[model samples]
Target: METPGNEERRPPTVPEGIPLLDEEAKLPQNERPELLIITGMSGAGRSRTAAALEDLDWYVVDNLPPRMLAALARMMTPGEGGVHRLAAVVDVRSREFFAELVSVLDQLRLQGTDYRIVFLDADDDVLVRRYESVRRPHPLQGDGRLLDGITEERQLLAHLRRRADVLIDTTDLSVHDLARKVREVVAGESDRPLRLTVVSFGFKYGLPLDADHVVDVRFLTNPYWVSELRHLTGTDEPVRDYVLGQRGATEFADRYVDALAPVLDGYIDELKPFVTIAVGCTGGKHRSVAMAEAIAQRLRDRGQSVRTLHRDLGRE
Candidate 1:
């Protein structure tokens, strides 16, 4: 009979037949249903993570109050309500309801309900940029500056960060990278391999936002000057050969990939999931695409996982 606003006034009373802490722990780990509590900094990719989990067939509830976790957990039973995987996006937006999270989590543990917490975080500068991009005020910002709210949130979440089963820092991660990390975590894949995305773009169209590294191929001879090559795209054999046959093209690709050896190794060592290498030219039709393909080939030859994206490839 406990209500959301009354959580601080009294602890939630578990319904009858719901196993208490001692009894719950005795059940095998696999026997217990899955409950994932998603929380963390406001702009730290919580929504994206939730969407990813949903794509993986998880039942996701957003902005759920912590006090309701036990009730939701009951529905997560395989037979009782048929929801095996449940992910709750809980955060400070619940206002006072969020204050009960710590006690509620402890209560769940004592009652024997097994759950895992994933905490997402990002650098302050990155968070600020995200907020500015979205034009949304931080939930705790009130009238203060964005940093003030972020600072307050960090202070409040410090304990939970330490308690989290998984802590993901999204400072350098793109949304796709975040999704891959979430999938890996859910699948219990401990050794995550680094995935690479090489994007071909035009300098005139601006740089790719998710690019971790950028290589300008405009230094090479412009194939656009060749009347026959101008009509063909990079995928055409003639354009590909012409572009890669430029004076410094092959040497540049070899040296750049060599230079990236340590950087790529460092990324893997640090457990970073994805790196985007953007190759750009004046128009993105010729040199950039060819170089991107060559770079991706070199990466694949070194046994790296790589995918190529041609942005602005047909814009001309």
Candidate 2:
């Protein structure tokens, strides 16, 4: 569980600004490997995201000092930790250590080490609620309201957020939703089948900002109108039957699949790895969920790897 270079002998204080690499990094910069920086707001789900990456075979480092990133990269070896892919979960929790991020990024650039940053974010109100629910003070909150701490943290992270390679807004996402985003973004070519995520969401909660493909299924019948199925969700047999059994419901799935073939093909041909399809209805409770399931099954039948999520299944 030791992070790369974490327990190894080193100076008590790392030099400010530029990163210092060990002897292993002496080779020309062109030989460097891949690195993923997982950072962002304190309560925006960095822990869950990092855990998801670990499940996907990444060599995960928690709370690693930014200044030691280069050394850690250089120190990673297949025999020790199988660090072909390195993901470091860092945040503002380590105040001084985190301050060295900009300089460390510059060093990585100079070393030609490919790097991508996944920035996790959420709405202020949502963040406050999450903190309250957990009964934990915000990391930036010293002697003020939770909102004050959130505002301060947002200000601190504004710069890094702008530079993020992937920005995930978790304001309304479930843990599964966030995990799917993490998996899709980090999956290697070998795990390409998971390049697509099919999710069901309620338009009332707002569109899933992480979606690359937005499909509105509101045109379909509203199962909520039928009192008998109103309480049931898309996952339920009666609700699904009510939704898909409606006119043009099954047809829509068929035609949509045909229409998406060329688009999916183009993404694959262009080497674009991830796609999130958001299916929405008035309430994510019924119609959207069932259609999402049907569409996901169609894609699966075609041999594509896909995970279906109902973002507002019970929020109704």
Candidate 3:
């Protein structure tokens, strides 16, 4: 029998999982931690996700038992160790302890702990490649083919998958993408760069796939109707002048930016890193492009570093 290096070093017993204690900390504290429970398909980038959280200044614990989450939380005092946030990375290596996770979550909820779960997922082929590249057998593989182990593990994790607060599919994601996704979800509360994306799109081309906020510029007068501006795009001086001079153009831009200020402030307060705003017009060639540029200038004036993407710019 040939054994791989990782298989030989891997531990057989899985630890019990639990959140931190509430009994010892009955008294109020100055700073309370926001707990994040990181669990997902093995080889699906759980380790990478944890590393991203750590880089964001979260107090992270790996391979913890479900029964100890409360006790562990009680031990940390906020100011003493810059731990306003905590994360626990757990897996299904231990069968008996894995079953206790649902109950542990119930306990945390009853105690009023604000916690969230982030589950990582990937395609079966991707999982297999990752496992084979590392030459490590699946944690649940007792005696079976590699795919058999993967199948069994997926079935085992089905319940948790349903309950996950955040699910990330890493099938086509790179390491940097994984990190960026995590940073976006958590808002890098510890301090990270803010990412602002303004997507200009055409209503006829459907909608931007990843837009968190959508702004419709189709209500504005269309430059396509005027024969003189018909051939010109929004970037052209004459088209820009025409679009901005429309009846409600400046009003819409000013009002939307004013309304967005509070939302952006909330994101910053909550420690979120990225938000995408999609601006759309009928054809995406003139009116939408002009309005997108206007909104982007406003965002930049607010000190936000903005990236403008014209999704249907050349399609017309």
lDDT of each: 0.89, 0.83, 0.83
Give the TM-score of each candidate: 0.52, 0.50, 0.51
Per-residue lDDT of model 3, residues 1-316, tens digit only? 4477545443333353454355576434446667888888989999998888876767899888888887766655566566667888877865679888888988988987778888999999999999999999988877888899889889888989999999999999988778878887753443454678988899899998899999988888899999999998888999999999989899999899899988987776555668999999998999888889999999899888898888898897
Whose lDDT is higher: candidate 1's or candidate 2's? 1
Q: What ordering of candidates by TM-score runs from best to worst?
A: 1, 3, 2
Q: Tell me the tens digit of each residue's lDDT in model 1 across 225-286.
A: 99878898887899999988878889999999999999998886555668999999998999
| Candidate 2 ranges with C-alpha deviation above 4 Å | 1-32, 77-81, 188-316
Candidate 2: residue 1 Cα off by (Å): 57
Where is the poorest 10-residue window by lDDT in model 2? 25-34
Least accurate 10 contiguous residues by lDDT in model 3:
8-17
lDDT for 114 in candidate 3 is 72
- Report the CA-based lDDT of candidate 3 relative to the real structure: 0.83
The residue pairs found clashing in candidate 2 are: none
Better of 1 and 3 by TM-score: 1
